[model samples]
Each structure stands twice: as structure tokens, then as C-alpha cells.
Target: MKNEIKGCIKALGKLIFSLDDVLNEAVEFPKEHFQPCANLKTNLKLFAAALQKIDGKYMARKDECRRLMAQEEVALAKCLCHFRAGNFSMDLLQKAVTLAAVYGTRRQAKEMKREAQKIAFQYDLRSQNKNLVTDSKAKWEIMEQLMADIAHNINPADYQPEEQIAWEQILDSFEEKLREKNLDLKGMDYNSEIEELFTSAREAVVPLKLAEKLKEVAVERTKKQKTLLETLERGRE
Candidate 1:
């Protein structure tokens, strides 16, 4: 029984490492890619299922260990009762001690099993939380990139009156969603907001549009700095 319990512990350790690796890889995939979402969701469900199987096995082993411990206790009690009933002999006393040792060993095994079960439960919860966070972050990153791309491609001045109104409304709706998710970009300048959205998008996957937009923003900023410097020099003269 001791050897069996040890083996179970070792197996559980390996399972934990395997699950961690699967989740890490799933989380690292690019959010803009369809494959990441599909893979992450599928793997997360599979991990949960695997955990269920491990939990079932753990419960079975625990029940068996409890039953064995209870049996040992009963046998020990019986031996004590016989000794109390004046059947005290060297043989009976030795038998009682043997039963006591078995009970002690069984109790230790139960403790180990209980500890392992606690660790497993904690790990399962951590894995579930990680899945949720990664999924949410990926979705947010994809949305951010899409919004940034739209912003970069469409100039406010080039739109017709009706198109401008409709585009603003759409942007407003998107901003509202971000607010609802507690991701506020309120009070941030256009360039700063764009940079932030780009940063968030790059957290999961780097979109080509993001790089192009960043380059454009950088050039615009440099031109503005140059104009400002020229104005200051004229003022000095």
C-alpha cells in the first residue's frame, strides 16, 4: 500500500507538469489568429477533463485507504477487548502491537493522501483561472488591433458628412464596450490611446498593421517636433 501510494504521488506530479506545459503553450498563441482561440478553448476543456479523471482516481484511492484504516482500528479494538476480558497473553499482546503499528502506518498514508488532494485541488483552480485570464486577454487584444486598424485606415476629414457621423458612432460604441470591461482609455490623447491599444494587441500576437501604424505615428510625431522647434527659433530671432 505504501509503495502504491508513492507511485500515485509520482504520477500526479508528472500530470501537473504536463498540464502546465499545455496551458502555457495555449496561452502563448497569437490572439489575431483563429487557431489560437480554437486551440486554447479546446485544450482548456481537455485539461479540465483530465483533472476530473485524476480526481476520480484520487477519491477511489482515498476511500480504499480509509476502509483499510477503519478495519485496522476495529481489529485493534477487538484485541484490546480480549486482553481486558482477562485473555492477556504474550501472543495476544504482540498481535495488538502489530495492529497498532498497522493503524499508525495507515493513518500516515491517509495524511499523505489528504495533502496530495489539497495540492491537486489548488492546482486545478489555478489552471482554470489562468485559462480564463488568457482567453479574455486574447479576445481583448484582437479587438484592440481591429479598432486600431480601422482608426489608422480611415481619416476623419476624408469621410462624407454621413459617413463621418456613422464612423464616430461606431467608435463610440467600441469605446463604451471597453469602458464596460473596465479598460478605460478616456482622457488619453489619440496617439497615446493608439499606442496603448497597439501594446495590448502585441501582448498576444503582433499584427502587421500595428507595425505600420506605429511607423506612421512616429513620423507624424517627428514632423510636429520639427515644426515646434522652428517656431521657437523664429520667436527667439
Candidate 2:
């Protein structure tokens, strides 16, 4: 799993470098119609650096995998936002969306695919920017092939980490432990084994030092869900 994740990220980094190279060539190609954004190369460079820095070893543990995936998704999001904020071409937009869909969870991939479809719709509606549209079309086949190769090398489950642990899951685990220890919570059995079980349950659910971190995760997850819903609503409208 670690090797697979590392390979996927390496492939993505290469793709970003190729993209940056293309942008650089476009700058020197003596084209009047399609000038790349000033910060486009910088953004791509930063994003590539971020991807290269991801610790693929984190896949060894579930909690580490969760955090690693979150960090990766955030980097992708920041790159996409940078592109959206500038006057980048349609191809750049599609590329960002493709990367996001590939690296994100199932829900994230679904949302990104919707965004890509919307881009296609808008491309069909607009009469101007034919050169830009043509350029995007020419690159689409190659991009698809590259993405396919990358996707084939990765495990889908690695991208789809369990984002949150439900309260019921921990409660069920606690209950099972209680049953094994033959200790009733409401009974007058205050033995050391019962005390240890309670301690373990508390540690599993909420360690003292990690409580604030867990709260932050909850808040961040909520914010992401809210943003995704709003994006979906806007797409519907």
C-alpha cells in the first residue's frame, strides 16, 4: 500500500511538472490569443512540491492514512482555487478537476466529476475562445490516458480513507469490552479490570491531549460537507 500510494503521488508530481513545462512552452510559443496566467506556473510548482512531500508511509496506520489523505485533498483544493481565481484556460481547469477526482474520496470524486461536466457544458455554450477550446480538446485524450495509467497503479481504498469515526462504533466496542470483562456498568463491581477497561475506552474515544485535535477535525469535516453541499446546490441551480 505504501509503495502504491507513493507511486501514485510520484505520477501526479510528474504530471504537474509536465503541465508546468507545457505552460512554459506556451509562453515562448509566440501565441497572441492564449497567454497563461502569471502565477499559473508558480501555483503548479507549489502544488507539485506539496504532492512530493506527502508521507506515503502514513498508510501503515488508519489514523495516519486519514490525516495524510486530508492533507493531500487540501493541497489539491488550494491549487484548484488558485486556478479558478486567475484567468486560466479551460484545459487547466479540467486538469485540476481531474487531479482532484483522482486523489479525493468517493464523494469528492463525484463532486469533481460534476464540476468537470459543468465545464464541458459551458465550453459547449460559449462561441468565443475556440482556440482555447480546441487546445483543451487536443489535450483531453492524452490527459485521460495518463490519468488511466496512474489510476491503475493505485488502490481506490487508499484514496477513500474512513474520514470520521462514529460515536456508535466506539460505544459498541465499549459495550463488547464490558461484556467480556463481565462487568455491568450499573452494578457495584468497581474492580481494577473494570477500571482498566474504562481507561482503555476513554483513550480510544478521546485522549486527554487529543481532544482539541479531534474537535478541530470535526469542525473541519463539517465545513467541508457544508461547502460540498453548497457546490452541489449551485450546480443544480
Candidate 3:
């Protein structure tokens, strides 16, 4: 029983460590990039507390540990949805607000909605400017769609391979435009951080199977994104 408890503690410790890494990255992001809910830190704290509750009798505290771990995972995923290279759309922010309502205060949820509306208004004004390049407009619209799809947890497997391939071409074209402008998708770096998060989660004992599925999704997303960037250099020439 003592050994089992030690194993559980070790696994939870790894998960907590990964969550800390991604949350720290989120904190360093610019305000315009994404707004992480303040409650994420609180969620992390509660999970950590559960870890501390472990003793020689693992069964006694097992349920509580499982519950906290599940809650933390949901909160972390919700926070991650808000992260994008540029400003998020009102739709995406509203979705985030809904997801956050499960763990955040009513006041915080209302504030998020207000922020979303303000940003949406600003985007509308920006779209009306005659000086903005056509490419910039197209890129913004496509990225917004992509981010929204991710926020909605759209399964890549749900689409046919041909459809997926076509989307990849679209992304390649988008990345090429960014290359011409000497800009890169900054959110690609966040995907790497998310990949690391799943790597840690996969090590935990309680939700090992679920973690594997999540990691597979994260890994595939990162892989597709990196592939596009890799081809951009040669394709541009």
C-alpha cells in the first residue's frame, strides 16, 4: 500500500509540474494574445493540495485525488482554448467564458464576456479600414476559424482524409503569406508547450489512458503545424 501511494504521488507530481509549465507560459503571453482565467491558478492549487493528502493508506484518499485531477484537466484545457497568436474573436471568447463558468466565479465570467465584446468591436473597426491589406484580412479570418474549431474541440478524425489534406494546403498557403510578411504563427510555440503538458499527463497513473488519447491529439496537431513551417522555407524559394 505504501509503494502504491508513492507511485500515485509521483504520477500526480508529474501532472502538476506540466500544468505549472503551461500556466507559466500563459502568464508570460501578452494581454492581447489571450486572457487566461484567474481561476486556473486556484485549480492548480487544489490539485496540489490533493497530492499532499496522500498517506500510507492510498485507498482512503483515492477518490478525492481522482476528482481533483479530473477537475484540473478540464480547467487546463479550457484555459488553453483561449490562447491564440492574435486577438481572439468574440465567438471564441464567449465559448471560453462558458467553459470557465464551470470553475470560475460569476463575476469573472461576466468580465470575460465584456472583454470579448470590446475586442469584437475593435476587430470590426479594424476590418473597415481601407488601408489594411487583403492578405491580412484573409489571414485573420482563416485563423479565427481555426482557433474557433480548436476551442470547440473538433476531432480531426471526424473529417475525411481528403478534406484534411485540403485544409493542410490552405494552412500552407496561409503560412506562406505570413512568411512573405516576415511574421510567424506565435501560437505554434504554445502548441509545443501543450505537447509537453500531455507528455507529463501521460505519465500519471490514474488517468493514464485518457492522458494517452489527449497526448495523441496534441502530438498530431503539433506535428501538422511544424510540417507546414518546415516546408515554408523551401516553398517560398
Candidate 4:
């Protein structure tokens, strides 16, 4: 765990230093040469590492990624690196506000990064204690996970968001039904129809384990709901 933490921290610091350099030297920097989005996400997986034993168990975590100065949330983030904030362009500021709704404001991102650093520092201090075991099972497990993630880093962006895919599938299903029944599309509510499909999705597109878990949940929920109703009826009496 400690070893993995060290790798993560190193990665994060490298990412931060690169971003800060860009932010501080916006004029002198070459926009085409630097890749802020890729750098921020990739290097965030690295930072300084530390460890501690809490309640007789070792705990290890990476310092959260800090991309405040350079990493903008996608388009918004790109805009800052591309244009000068000192220019006071209303268009840029409006774009910033729009993107901030989803990605959070730059000020907020800065604070989050700062807070993460503080937490990381705490861990660093804990790691300084010589009592931690260097040869532990947890340490190796973390190292393995880190290596695997690096080797096969398939992020969600590799495909469309699940919600979007489901919506398209539902739309197709609805279209098929409309054509079969010779019905007008005018009174159909896609949102409600989607909800209905989800509610009755006993055969929803999911892996076997997830489907089984849902079944278990349904049975557990029904049992609890039944018990609550019986208790309520008794109280009324």
C-alpha cells in the first residue's frame, strides 16, 4: 500500500508542476505543444505516497489529483489554457460559468485540490513512522492494482455514457412498437417510458452478477416493506 501510495503521489506532483507552469506562463507557453486534459488525468494517477497502521490495520491512499491551475473541466479547462483570463473576455467568462455548473468553478476546484494536498500531507506524516511493515500483503495488492490500471486504462469515455445508450435503445424499442401498432408518436413521453422500462426491467441489459444482486435486492425490499406494513396495521389497531 505504501509503495503504491508513493507512485500515485509522484504522478500527481508531476501533473501539478506541469499544469502550474502552463498557468503561470500562459503567454510564453505553446498551446499546440501541451496537452492539458491528457496530462491532468494521466498524471493524477501519480503523487507522493505514505502509509500508517490504524487500529492494527495498514491504510494507504494517494493524494487526490490537483489540476486547478491548468486542468479545466474539458472545454472550459481548455479555454483557460488557450486564452488569457487577464483579457477579461466576457465570452470566455460566460463559457467558464456555463461549464462550471457541471465541472465546478475554478475557485472551487482550487480549494478541493488544496484540501486534498493537506490530507496527503497527513498521510505522509503517518508514513514517516518506522513501525509500518514493508513486506505486507496489502502493499503488494495495491501495487498489482496500480500496474494493472496503468496497463489497461480503459476509461468510461471509451464508449458512450450508459444512460445515453439506454435512452437510444428505449427510443428504438418505442419506434418499433409505434410502427407495429400504427400509432401516432405525438402523445408519447420518452422520459416516462424510459422510467417504466427501468421499473419493469427484470430482463434489463446487465451482467449476470448485477442481475442476481438486483433480484436479491428486490426480495429483501419486498420482505422489509411487508414487515413495515404489518407493523403499521398493528399500530392502527
Candidate 5:
């Protein structure tokens, strides 16, 4: 189970990296228009449903996963501003909290909580920059902080000293590369990892009952998203 969790985290990290890369390529595309509203929302709902499925199965640390999923929805709400960019900036903050609480020791969890607070501040900064912040601290500040934040993640406090050192080095290297490319680590909290977690949980095929529950949740979220989009359009009109 431990190894499985590690693999899942790493795979999720890679997926987050890929998503950030896509956002970074926004040289010409509108920041929030990389994907159509309907498609972006559908994918997000699917991912959230997958997270819900895994949270139901994993019992342990399931609360953390649930909390993260809630935060993800909050992040997605920014997509209503389709003309703006970077609605996913708080993703790592959510993921870091979950990862620390679930897999780290007491000290690491504390560190992650601190990280979360800083990220929340960044979210405020980003918001203010949209309409309020002066030229001093703009959106780029948030991006720069995030690009640095990933490196400072506390290793699971239980790791051996050597392991912790190596992990820190890895994070440093990863962040450096992202900086070199001027990419914002905006999508670090992807829930798509839950799909793999669900598969791993069922060595046998997904249980019929669990599958049905997830399907229902997805349908409900999709409906909610449609309603939200309609409301936004109405407000525009």
C-alpha cells in the first residue's frame, strides 16, 4: 500500500507537470481558454468523481482527499472568467496539504499547513492583481512563488536522512527546470490520479455498486456545471 501510494503521487506529479506545460504554452491562447468551458468542466467533473471513488475506497486518509477535492472545485470556479488566465494556481496548495497530512509525519504536516497558508495569500494576491494590486506585485509574483514553493515541500518527516536529502535535491532540480522554462506550476493538484487509485483498489473489476455511485456523482456535478455556465452567460447578457 505504501509503495502504491508513492507511485500514485509521482504519477500525479507528472500529470500536473504536463498540465502546467500546456498552460505555459499559452503564448497565444487566452489564459483561461485553453479548453472550452464545457470540455474543461466535463473533464474536471470526471476527475472529481474519480477522486470521490478512491476516497470512498481508501478509508485511510480519505478525509484529506475529500478536502482536496473540495479545494479543486474552488479553483475551477475561476474558469468562469474565460478571458483571464491561470485559474488553477491553488492546486498545489491543496495537493500539498493532502500529501502531507496523509503521508508525512507531524512536522511535515505542519510545514505543509504553512505552505497552504502562503498559497492562500498568493491566491489573494492573484485576485487583487486582477483588479486591485499595483504594479509592484502582479500575477507574476504568484507564479514565481509557486515555482519556488514546490521545492520547499517538507519531505515526509519519517524519511531517513539520506532519503530526505535526496528528495529535497529532486524537488530543487524539478523547480529549477520549471524556472528555466518560465512555467507556472499551476496544476499540481490534479485529481486524475484517483482513476489509477480506483483501478488499483479493484484487482477484480470495479464493484458494481461503487461504479454506480461514482456515475451518479459525475452526473450531478455535470448538471451543476451546466447551471453555472448558464448563470454566467446570463450575467454577461
Candidate 6:
């Protein structure tokens, strides 16, 4: 009877470890590709509830293990919520696959791998339009840097209230000029010189907007950083 009890306890311990591993992998699942749409939210809630049930079942059997497993399950649910909230970008599928490989069931790992491949294909398609991606990426980078500079309070004294107003007017004038020139930044071909010209014009206006918004509390910079980090982390998971 003593040997049988010990064997049962050992089996229960192994089962709890398996559950913990699964919870950890679930917590690290990539959010970008599997964004928590309404369906995902429901699924995650159901999974949490199921985990809680499991904890209850094991409570008397191995209270300490149950407690730890429950905590991990809850953490996994929260991570899913974060992913669904658009906290992470689609780039995190790669990380998800890696994490899944470590602790996921065969089915779960396969699903993750499939998602990673899909994301890679989408990225390849995007890259085929190299000029557009390059230009858009450049514009985004410049905007990001300008926002960061403003956030860091690095603006010059010349970028005061009056100067900011004047700068806005200047931007308005520039917009009118582009209109007169029959140039629409959004409609131009990325590979065209016209598009390059428009890009330059837009870049010229970045500093003015930075100056204007510098005095105000802008969370845009931090939000972008958070979004990017979440996206990358999701992919790496």
C-alpha cells in the first residue's frame, strides 16, 4: 500500500509539471497573427476556466503544485488578452513557434509553425513591392525619431508657441503648394521621382509638428515603442 501511494504521488507530480509546461507555452503564444479577436477572447476565457477546474480537481491531491499551475494558467490567459488587444504585432509568430516547440503538444506546435510560415509568406509579398516598403519604412522611421526627440524634451527655444503656430501655417502653405503642383502623396508611385519629392516634402514638415506637440503630453512615441516591442516579443516567443 505504501509503495502504491508513492507511485500515485509521483504520477501526479509529473502530470502537474506537464500542465505547467503547457501553461507557460500558452502564455508565450504569439499575439500578432492570432490577435485576440472576439473568437479568441472567448477561447481564452474558456481555456482559463478549464484550467481553474483542473486546479480545483488537483487541490487536495497536490496543493502546492496546483497553486503554481493555477498561477501559470492565469498568467497565460492574461498574455492572450494582451496579444488580442493589439499589444503585439503579427511579427511574433516566429517566437511563438519556438516557445511552442519547447512545451506544446504536437498539434499546438504544428499550428504555431503553420502560422509562422503564413506570416513569412505575407512578409515576402510585402517585400516584392520593395520601393513602397522602403519608402513607407523610411517615413515611419523619421516620424518615430521626431516623436522620440519631442518626448525627450530636446526641442530648441525657437520651437516655442508662437513659432509652432507659424510652423503650422507654413505646413498649410506647403500643402497648398503640393495641391497646386497636382501632387498627391498617397496616390503617387513609390518608384517615381514625384513620390520621392513628396516624401521629402513630408520629411520637411516633421520638425514643425514635433515643435508644436512638444509642449503637450503625447503618448504616441511610447505607444509606438510598446507596440513594436510587443510585436517583436510575440514573434520571438
- Among these predicted structures, which one has the highest TM-score? 6
Model number with the top lDDT: 2
Candidate 2's TM-score: 0.25
Model 5, CA-based lDDT? 0.36
Each model's lDDT: 0.37, 0.43, 0.39, 0.33, 0.36, 0.42
Deviation in Å, model 5, residue 148 alpha carbon: 26
Candidate 5 residue 2 Cα shift, in angstroms, is: 53
- lDDT leaderboard ranking: 2, 6, 3, 1, 5, 4
Model 6, residue 34: what's the lDDT? 47
lDDT digits (tens) for residues 176-202 of candidate 4: 554665754332333444334433432
Write the residue-wise lDDT of candidate 6 on 1-237 in tens digits.
344435444543564457664554342333343454433224334433434443444454432223333333433333333334322333344445654554455676687678556645655633544312222332233223332332133221111223222223333444466678785444234344544554455456557566566535346544643554454345434
- Estimate, for each residue in 1-237, the C-alpha lDDT of model 1 and write its tens digit: 445555434443343345443233222112231112233223223323322332333333432132223323434433333322222333434455564433333443344345334534544423533321122333334333443333333321122112111223334455555676677443333354555544553433434565665668747745854654454345435
The predicted structure with the larger lDDT, 4 or 6, is: 6
Count clashing residue pairs per candidate.
0, 0, 0, 14, 0, 9
How do these models rank on TM-score, best leading?
6, 3, 2, 4, 5, 1
* Candidates 4 and 5, the one with greater lDDT: 5
The parts of candidate 5 lying over 4 Å away from their true place are 1-73, 76-198, 202-206
Give the Cα error of residue 145 in candidate 4, in Å: 27
Each candidate structure's TM-score, on Cα atoms with residue i matched to residue i, is 0.19, 0.25, 0.28, 0.24, 0.21, 0.29
Off by over 4 Å in 2: 1-79, 86-88, 123-128, 131-237
Worst 10 residues of 4 by lDDT: 47-56
> What TM-score should be assigned to candidate 1?
0.19
RMSD of each: 30.9, 21.5, 18.3, 21.6, 20.3, 16.0
Residue pairs in candidate 1 whose N, alpha carbon or C atoms collide under 3 angstroms: none
Which parts of model 1 are misplaced by more than 4 Å? 1-63, 102-237
lDDT accuracy of residue 3 in candidate 4: 47
